[model samples]
Target chain A: MTEKLNVFAVRTLTQKEYFAPGHRACQGCAEALAVRLVAKALGRNVIIASATGCMEVVSSPIPFTAWRVPWFHVAFENAAAVASGIESGLKVLMRKGRLPRKKIVTIALAGDGGTADIGLQALSGALERGHDFIYICTDNEAYMNTGIQRSSSTPFGASTTTSPAGKVKMGQITWKKNMPAIAAAHNIPYVATACPSYPIDLVEKVKKAASIEGPAYLHILSVCPTGWRSAPELSIKLGRLAVETGIFPLYEVEHGKYHLSIDFPRLRPIKEYIRLQGRFRHLTEEMIGQIEERVRKEYAELKEKAAKGVAR
Target chain B: MGKRVGMEVSIAAAEAVKQANVDVISAYPITPQTHVVEHLSELVANGELDAEFFCVESEHSALSVCVGSEATGARSFTCTSSQGLALMSEITYIASALRLPIVMIIANRALSAPISIWNDHSDVMSIRDCGWIQFFAENGQDVYDHVFIAYRLAEDRNVLLPAIINMDGFTLSHVIEPIEFIEQEKIDRFLPPYQPVHRLHPDRPVSMGGIALPPIFTETKKAHEVALQGSMPKILETWKAFGDMTGRYYQPVETYKAEDAETIMVIMGSFGETASAAVDLMREEGRSVGLAKIRLWRPFPFEAFKQATLHAKQLVVIDRAISIGGPGGPVASEVKAALYGEPIRPVVYNFVAGLGGRDVSPSDFIKMVDKAEIEIEEGNREGYEIYGVRE
Candidate 1:
């Protein structure tokens, strides 16, 4: 089933900036774009806990930081854990009449490797504890900060520094871990997947996640031109392709009920998304067929689950 | 004065945090340390204390969250034991390096391979160089008093460093003792509000825990070192203020009957009480023995240590943990280093004892001192001995 693309109701973003300029991110960085939009949605009444990744490294370089909002840079594997403390800390302050504001949003920003691999246990723990915070995983497929190493979030058939297409091996041999599904299994109030290509969709998901009472996890598919071996200017285009080709579906799960946000009834071929990226150029026809088959099967499963209505 | 009541040392530690008006307590449950957090959780739940009690999943997250909350300008506390403290070792350095004033209570337990959940100094000694100002508590009163003392020293703007209060596991944590609970009003006047100079506020943003390149890494380390070393004055000043308020004095290096004694026994943690008892027995027997207890381990109190031991001819240093194939015990090694350049110092002898929950009584301490005195008189001072070990 498909829903109408309501672009008219989605208002244009405000001029105020929280993720200020002068960050050392690569040009046309999709993750940077997502962070800007995410910050805009969160507004100023928030504290951010960022794990050691591209976003953290670029935004903060000692004595000079791009973050205008209150931000903390903890270790790589404990962004969610840190956010839990921030939320609880603020709650205690408010209850004790120490803080003037009764409430403040607590958010965590982590990279693919931080969310899917090193930080998975912390993420799981925060969600299970039902802390009032939003955990955003800006998935750039691989560890873009550490020279394009393969992470669990790296999709199958994508070549990375650790998962190179050598003489015997083609590329990455395993499928990308379903991080959103793992988050949903925590039974948190909200879990969603978004793309930075559609700024309004991404911002809307973030705002919705922030409004939820308990923990909300938002997984954003951020494109990495340098890691993906694509043109830097084509970052937005690649992000759109990831969604349009059914490679990274745009959907939200509320109270364990799945709802598609951007449903492309007639999906574009995966080749359109893979051909431009040099990381996937080493793929053979047989391997492409296998990937395609796997994508279709997963998409079918998602549709069936979404159509099943609210989980009981 | 609030009240004088007999309370479990762990519960007294929790009450001390309550008196400090801590804003957040993020802890993972571990044996011996569990009772402290349990009482804290009860206080938060019962509305007796208005604070956040986070049942963090692991010790790593417990300390990680404390770092997060403390950076946000909140008074935070946490507690852990052997494996829990070991699990939190990585973030322990981060908490200090970032200069987050989060106070933690470590109910000391032995690190395992034999897997014993008993009282020992191994856990505290394992992370000796983590850069936190560590204190050893001899009893329930010290545990209660130092909780307030640690927060005051840690939260000082000049010394924005994390602190650890170590109490012997099962021995002090499980033992009930009569303690004077200070009034909250007095604590408020003494501690004042923790006004964070640099905090994570959206209105006034400041970046913490930033990456320091090699060019500035050395400077950052120097700053941290200077800050730690410079904290000694503030530590003494804080103890003076606390002592004035409560009439219970504390010092970096405390002594008992050591003014004219030829031989002095040095110890830490709960064993300090036992060592003092042994010193009294030795004095009764006219053996000219005394006791010196190290309360402040970090900022190592080198001046105080030197001053305390200069008059003694010999020192029987008791260590509950071994350095394992390197030198002697950790405390013994630090003690030797502290005394190396001194013109007049004791012929220090190390005795590793009371490990893995093994009880070291007052009689045992007396016997160890006797052995050490005999060794020194016979000019047989060589390697350190494992006191009371079944050889």
Candidate 2:
């Protein structure tokens, strides 16, 4: 049941990039990095239906765009639903010989708020309907575009504008939504959790998901330094720390089988991941111990599930 | 002209979608509208219509799917009823704002408070300003014909906006009627292939539905308004072309014996038929009563409506939906606003009738007209009256 990471190789990217530069994303936005990798992975013959959130606003401003591919931004909660339409439309055209391309890769990209909170119903519907598209959730924990409000994906005890740390109440009181598990419950063909710090893993997962015939879900832990109250330069560091500490594991569920893609032999304490972020500044030693216990319990459960290879 | 066949209204509507050769249909079933999508699904399933049929999870996703496919230059379609349309309300606005040119058929039904499952105009009124070109179909013939008209006008490069064809729930939807079914070749010649001026294609990349900030927000809205108002000519031209081919003509306003009448009744949707019958009875009695049916709801048909009511001294406006605490019903308010500054204005009487499937027969229409005349003379026509209300 143990899994090991592949040895580091020379990082080379595809020559053709669909996501161009000059996007209005922040200096060290990990979501932007993930999108760049995803665009490269899904090189050509792709259409992206994005939701109304940071990625969409940053990529497409009023008369300018950073996308070199055909892109659409619908309402906040219907990215997956919109992509379902695109997939169906393309299929019809291809079948009728109206379109020159025999196949097109359709992807929907959304932020944590657009994926886990407001947009979850549409995502669930799209997955249940088995649309031939890949939905990528760029989880930044909070609604960063709206000035750091807490989303359902915001981890327990992380301070957001809406979940600010105060004298009586701790930061966030709820656990991060388990989106991959929810997607797994739909019994889609592919479900994976990825991190931007691991470009090779993220890109590979995107490519794999694009090749999937049925619905595929990819949850990427996109680090947001501004929302997390950490140094912008620590975006990549935080992404790596998140996966390394078992707070966010990199794994895939294909059909009904679970396989760990990036398994840590030994996990660091929860503080190793939270200490660099000011959002966790109010955590006492007792609180940190509690968080550690919770993380260990959840990691142990995920590990057991991966080992048992249970569909459910 | 094509052969006439006896078919259920819903099936005929589905046949129109088939003849249009739409590329995609995404729908979630609601009563009255279900038969339309159910038949469409069969057509797609049997390869009769080469289209993608998506049984979407909700009406929200149904219209959202249409927007997605329409942006890809596909002629997309979807149908819904009262609560279903309410569920799809948000995306309905986006479809028009994005200029997707989708054709949607709304089997008009009563909105829920008591949860009635019959016909009314509440569903259509709920989306009155969603920016889509809207039409009311009075019978099975209009439902079948308006489908083609909806597509033609909506897809015109000058129009490039979504359109809605509304038929009364269960009344026009479930009733079986003999309709002149047009051939596929004729439909092809009329509709042609939908060639979007701009669409989602990798060869020519375009960004759709971008955010409009403070500087350009009002300007964007202005552009949408101008586009809709500008679509009037194209709507007329498309109807004219269809009429030339089939001898079945349509206009923004159609009058029934209103040419030389002193009193007129204004109604939309299927109730127009009942009002026409009532007008015939009144005319036989040597009374100067007539009916003016409003087919086009958007673009207002200002000149046409004004011309239709200008000669009449008393005009009765029937509305099926209330604006709820506003002055009178939605239709009556619009009519009063339309006639406010005119030099020759009629004494308008607002009447709310046939709500939530309460049948307003021809006799009831006659009574309604009689009551409006009394109210006008008594100067009690300042507000609206709920026709047939016990109190």
Candidate 3:
């Protein structure tokens, strides 16, 4: 699927945007862009169950909705459970001859807090139940929808409202949860990590997820300029820097086989990514060195996993 | 007429759901509520009922699954009790707000503190204001019958809201009684396949459960209130239709020997039968006593309740659940509010009895009336009494 597309392959992607314009997202909100690319990949034959978060609040404000496809937003933590229901409902209806037996992908959308924090149990339940669905976790590190509070997905040393860098304490005290590893541990068919900055890679991954048989999980690192306290124009660049710095790697795990989406000959320095974001402004050189050591170790581990390329 | 079989109330309720041809059944097992979902799974497993039945991880997910399936245009059903209801109470409100028309059976039990899993109204009373159409069942038959009624009424175009059928936990749900099942062909004609007002479909796209801002929040609430209150006529119509088919009539506020009576006992749930027996025994003694059993709990049948109890000189309201400190009992408060400021209203007396499966027998009902009459004579009617208390 990747071989057919050229370097500037985003132009070859379908122009029909299932996620319409006129949404209420802030400028340079890459979460909204990630949603658009996901919508574009899945196209019209899909039903979306979105959790109550930034994208849901922005796109669906009562009488006006930016979703051109069938969409539902039930609550904050049950997007995966709702998607399970939708998948089962469509199957039973089709089997009972009440609905036409055509393929309609069921997709669940949620933000970082909604997925890694509140929605984790429900997502695990749905995946274990083996529902035919795609779960896209649009992670912006913090709970950006609700005033940038710290979430389980929030990285260490990143200042949030709840985990402020005060006189005694610095930023978030905990490491970001490895949601993709947890998802892959469920033995689901497909698990991937993508960013909106690489539109073609993200689109290909989404398409691949939609094609899979059972549960597929995509952990998208959606850059939130408002929450990160970064310049709006740096949203796309920050996403790229995140990938280049080996902070947020681009990879996929298919049937337990590890594959790196983009491999770097030499990773960029972590300072390039941290310096661009105000959330990490308080971090000293020593703190940066500590973060750099952890990132390097984790990136090496990921490279080793890819090198093995063995299905568990 | 269908066959009359002796079956446990929970099993019969599951049979009723099967007859309704529900497309989905998602529920988590709680005590007393377990039998209903267990039977449903068995039916689905045996191919007797072609429905999607699964036990979700938690009661919250159980109702969430129902909300999802129902919103996708599938007729959905679920059952729970006590803590399960409390766990899923959040989604119950969302389900009604979304107008999904899912049907649920609540095997009513006492809420925690001591964590007693027994018959009481505490579970149902906790969610009294959840915006779903609620009713109580007196026995196994009523529990079985209300399954069809709830689905029919809930799925109606004019009343696209969820409905709850509450039956006492062990007293009703676990007891075996002879239930006359309605014929499938008759149920087919009475309750047709659900046609959702709006659904998740690829061919015709629509978004549901959107965020309502301050600008239109009040209007949405008003519309929901109007829709719930407006469902009265359809509730009666559906009951009348079911009665016409089954030869068993039902009403929101059913009365027994209340005409020309000076004292009437107002009650709800399975204990209504015992209260009726007490009324019969009291009538044999030539006392002016009667019973008014309230079946429909939500959109309270104020007119019928008023008509039944207003003519009486004294009214005794039996509540199985207490309202903590504010009011003695929640039902008594509602009853008082319903008859407040009326020109010719009865003096209301409230008794909170049968807490946590302590049986309220026919004699207990008689004792309540006896105590109420004495208390009324002594002019001590400002608050309520917890009847049969040791203190």
Say which candidate scores most in DockQ. Answer: 3
lDDT of 2 by residue, A1-312 (tens): 011223323245566668889998998899999999899877767899999999988888788888998999989999999999998887877777777766678899999899999889999999999999999999999999989999999999999999999998889999888999999999999999999899988887887888779999999999988899889999999999999888999999999788888788789887989999999999889888888888888888888888999766
DockQ of the two-chain complex in candidate 2: 0.75
Model-by-model DockQ, in order: 0.69, 0.75, 0.81
| lDDT for position A238 in model 3 | 97
Model 1 / residue B97 / CA error / Å: 2.0
Local distance difference test values of all predictions, in order: 0.89, 0.89, 0.92
Off by over 4 Å in 2: A1-10
Docking class for candidate 1: medium
Worst 10 residues of 2 chain A by lDDT: A1-10
For candidate 3, the per-residue lDDT at A172 reads: 94
**How much is A74 displaced in model 3, in angstroms?**
1.0
Q: Which candidate number maximizes lDDT?
A: 3
Tens digits of lDDT, candidate 3, A204-272: 899889888999999999999999999999999999999999999999999999999999979999999
Model 1, residue pairs in steric clash: none
lDDT string, candidate 2, B1-391, tens digits = 6999999999999999999999999999899899999999999889899898889888998999999998888889999999999999999999999998999999988999989989889998999999999999889999999988999889888889999998999889999999998888888899887889988877788888887778888988899999999999998998899999899999999999998999989999888878888999999999999889999999789888998988899888899887788888887888888888889788888889889889999999999888888878888857478989876
Candidate 2: residue pairs that collide: none
